[model samples]
Target: MTVALASFSKEKLYPPAFDPGGLVYFGPMFDFVIGAAPDGSLSNETGALEAWEPNDDASEWTFTLRSGMKWHDGEDVTADDLVFTINEFASPDATCGGVCGALAANLASVEAVDEHTVKMTLKAPDVNIPAQFGPIEGSIMLLPQHHVEKVGWDGFESDPLGSGPWKFVSRELGQSISYEANDDYWNEGHQPKFKKLDVVLAPDQNTRVAMLKSGEADLIAISPDQVPVSQSDGFDILTVENTVFSEILFFKSSDPEELTHKLEFRKALALAIDMDEVIEAFYPEEAGKRTSGDAVPFSETTLGHDPDLEPYPYDPEEAKALLKEAGYDGSTIKIWTVTFPDGPEQKDVNEAIAGFWSKVGLKVEIVQSEFATLKEQIDKDGFDPAPGVAVTGFPTSNRPSVLTNMQSLMMSPDAGGSYRTYWDPKTADTLHAELAKIVDDATRDERLREINRELYEQYWSIPIAMKNTLYAAGDRIDGWEPISGISKVLSYETLRPTE
Candidate 1:
């Protein structure tokens, strides 16, 4: 079976935690320590972990490995491998982002008690640890210690090995990756249905659609606009709702003189954009749900979501008033918009937002860049060096824990830091510290709601809309289901030919 994706990484594909695009190829080749269920809840059915439990105060967790699990080289999958994986993720030099940041902050120690048992001690009692370790963006996947020790990190990157149902065959730097069925895969029920899998990168949506029609590709991920085209062509279009949210993240400038440091300026920018019109112009009704005050896209069903919270009303005049009240300096604020694999229309949406800001007496310049360039900038120089505000997709459904979401995005640099930082360090640290210690479900829920309310009022970020992920598949493929609550992670094991 063949699949076409929008983008692929040029770098060597090891330490899978760093690159989302790399995960498309390497994800099926490795198993996670924990897995998330269809509804974004914790599950042990899909990973190497057989069972786990928290101690009396919840500060410590013990995990038991699944019996008889073995790597592709026939090495037994044990607690030592899990220990090595966690330590690598927590390493200070690791390029991993939010997920590793959370682990480093809370994990006091992780040790293999026996061949099948591992014990983890935390700095604080956190119920969200399992969710952070699940198979989601930035989450750690179990790595074979023996292979890495033999090959070294760089060697492992060139030739990786895992215990997943699919084994890595070969990959072209920027074009494609191939895999073959692991006949000895531990999970009997979830064994690979097909012998070979090929994933190719075709950044152009039109080309991807054409490939699908021409029978060159069995499955392709399509954007919201392509829904009609795929539907009309009679292709099976699968959608996963509330997978991610389009958000305008405001970066705190190091210099206090910058306009970005002012909360009034950020609030004015938020109030200026008309999300309803933006949604209508660029997105399908099913894919575009206008977000309210909360930075994270949380529905009523999502934990810690406040349903009573309403969206900020569109009032350009009020935005102008706020700008004037803050002593308008006429400084040009740049809104950086990058091309995302899933949401190609982000540039158009950002143009509309820039127009709205311009009408509110603000000097707004829309700077368009590729996602790779922007990521490189942020990696070299922190968030402060980038544009004041950036339009990007923030995944929420895949991360069910609200505390984990906040810790990953809102915390300061000193406190194991977040990938995106906009809040006051002292306040954010205190709230996160307090929330992390709560063991009771009721108290945790209330505390989470309070934090959301605080962030909502503070204008942490501008939430545009919750986006639904859409995938189009041809008739040649069968028995494949879109992984719920996940945007790009594909279950290659369950995929089989129609015959």
Candidate 2:
């Protein structure tokens, strides 16, 4: 049996490439060796790694591999393979971006302890170490060391080898990608029921929906607005609250004396916009909830979230008063957003924010670009200190007690992307470093609560709302589950055919 799904990608599949353009095509081919357990802890159910423990004052970590795991070529998986994959991430010459680069920032060394065991040393102690290998998108993905070493980086891109349930078969760029189930897959009871898998690339949302309705596609991703209109016949609409926070960032300019760098200016801008209006305009009534105070909205479930803090109230009058006190010289402030696949048009939301800011006597300019271009600009040198505001979703993790989200989203540019925060970078980094050393639950909780309060009071970044991810599946598809770790992670592993 063959299962057909709709995926959006403009290029062919390329494994081990950290570029966003390549990651879009990598989901079906690669798998995170470690997966999150039922309670949001790390486990070895996927046979990526069976067990791991920290030693040497929490600076060194030892990992034990699961038995009987094999690569697509039928080669036995070993600790050497794991070491090689991590070395690629830790290499200075790697052109990777996003989570791969962020995680690699702290990797000091990786050594093979034995055939089934590997040990990793870190530059600093981190309580969120396991998440680097967790099932989140952009986390570490295991690669076949033999193939990569023989063919080299450039050659391996064209001939990718993976140990996941699916094996790459063929691809027609911007059209479709094909894969066959790994019959010799070592992991038991979790294999895909289908013999063959085909992913049709349809960049248009309407075309994807039409394909699902016409039986050309069995499953497709759709926006919340399309859910009500597309859920009539044999389709099942599955919704999951994403571990992502859609927020507006206020960047500091290269010149420290810029208007955006002023605390009063940033506070007034935050006060002028009504989050309820923004949520109601772009999101369906049941799709998104109003969120404020937290850097990542879903972070309330994390350890650092403070429940007692209140969000900044929406008051245009107060905004105007603050602006008056700051010396009334009108200047056009810039805001940026980009287009995304099967999601709300963020450009529209930015325009609404501009309208709100304009009412408070602030001149606003909404800058738009493609997602790829925006990411490139954010990663470029001196981009962090550039003066402008941009709108994008901040990614959080599913780990219940981890500080990975906090360190990535707010602490430093190396952990987080190059996005600038409202507070002093050095001070924020120092505070987070101190937080990382605490292993006691009580001490950690108290420190986290204090940091959460500071984040709210300092207005680091203005959080807009939490987003809901929606997927459309057909009647023939059964046993399908909502995505857990990251959006679109391991979706095929849990699916089976009803007919």
Candidate 3:
């Protein structure tokens, strides 16, 4: 089987350093301790751990590995490997953000209770422990301790070893990677249906669609705009809705004189843009839907999602009034648009938003750049002057809990590594800490709703739309369904061929 991806990272193929795109290339070669099920819920059924239970206070957890599991190198998957992996994730060197950061913050100690059992003690109770460690885009994966001890990080990257359904065959930098099926895979029912897998990088959307049409690829990720054409071409189209949330982030400025620092100004910016028009113009009906601030669509399914919260109404007249009340001087407000991999129409969406703002008598400038360059700039020169407002997309499919999403986008930059800097760190951090300690479902859900309400009321960021990921499969493919709510981590093992 061959798959074409929209992007690939040139960085080393280490799980710790992987972005969502990197996961598509290397994820199949490694197994996870817990993962998102097809129904968009977290479960240990498909992971190395057979069962897990928490102690009386929910501060300590015990994970029992499935018996007879073997690593790619033939070593038994044991509690020692789980301990090593968790310790590494907590280490200072591990990439910390999202769930990884959550684990690092709460984990007090991890030990190998026996060959098949691992015990983890936390500094404080966390009801979202499973979610924090599940195989989401930003979460870490279980590593082979023996392989790493023998070869080190560099060597492991060169020749990765894992207990996944596929084994590393070969690769070409920035071009393609190949893997062979692991016939001896522990889970017989979930073994790869195909014998071999080849993943190629075709960053351009047109190029990827062309490859799919020409029968050069079995599957390709595509934009919504290409859906009509692909469907006409008789290719099977697969879609997963509410996978990514595209929004405009308001970066905090210490200078109160700046428009972004003013509450009315932020609200004005939110109300000016007409999301319905934007969706109609750039996306198909099934591909996009308006969303409330910091919350993705289908909020009912996501924990902490507030049902009453609605997207800011499109009221240009009110927006103009608010702008006037804020004493706007019509200064040029730059909205940075990035060539993000997951957001194919980001430039178009930002352009439409700029037009809306212009109609409201606000001076808006669209500054275009690559996502990498923009990220580098933000990292180097903390949010102060530049990046006043930028258009970007975030994956919201962190299963079993939405706190991970809230932590990343709503929490203070110092605490959550959020790109948005306008939030009050002390207040957001305190709220998050409180939410983490509660174990009751009803209490947790109520608190989550409160957080969402707070973000919406404050205009934390301009909620735009929830985007559905589209994919086209060739005729040779049969019975392949992507896990809902996750845009990354294409479960190649689940793909079946036409018999």
Q: Which 10-residue span in candidate 1 carries the lowest summed lDDT?
A: 390-399
Off by over 4 Å in 3: 253-257, 292-298, 386-388, 392-400
TM-score of each: 0.92, 0.90, 0.94
Model 3 residue 302 distance off true place after TM-score fit, in angstroms: 1.1
**Candidate 2 lDDT tens digits, 1-499:** 3333344444534343454334435666665657664344466776488887887456788888887888888888888988987887666655444455555777888899889899888888865666656655345678788988888777765777888878888877667767888877776566778888887777678887778878888777777677677666657776555444567666553236556556666678789998788888777743555664554422565666676777678999999998887664886677766655434556677788889999998877777767667666766765643333545433333434545554544455655545554446666677657866776657887887777776666665677766565667877787565355455453575677887
lDDT, model 1, position 482:
43
Off by over 4 Å in 2: 1-16, 19-24, 38-40, 93-95, 102-104, 253-255, 379-388, 392-417
lDDT of 1 by residue, 1-499 (tens): 8889887754465663465555676787888788666555667887889888888677999999898888988989888999998898887756566667667767899999999999999988877677767765445788999999999888987788998889989988778889999999877867888899999888889999999999999988898888888989999876766677778776553336556566777788888988789888888875667765554534444567787788877888888888887776787777777766657778778788888988888777777777667656654543554334544443344355666556656667677555544646567767778877777778877877877787778776778777777778899976565456667567777776788
The candidates, ranked best first by TM-score, are: 3, 1, 2
Rank the candidate models, highest lDDT first. Answer: 3, 1, 2
TM-score (C-alpha) between model 1 and the true structure: 0.92
TM-score, prediction 2: 0.90
Off by over 4 Å in 1: 253-256, 297-301, 372-398
Q: Return whichever of 2 and 3 wins on TM-score.
A: 3
Pull out the clashing pairs in model 3.
Answer: none
lDDT of 3 by residue, 391-478 (tens): 5343345344766665675566566555544445567677767877787879888888776777677775676677677788999899
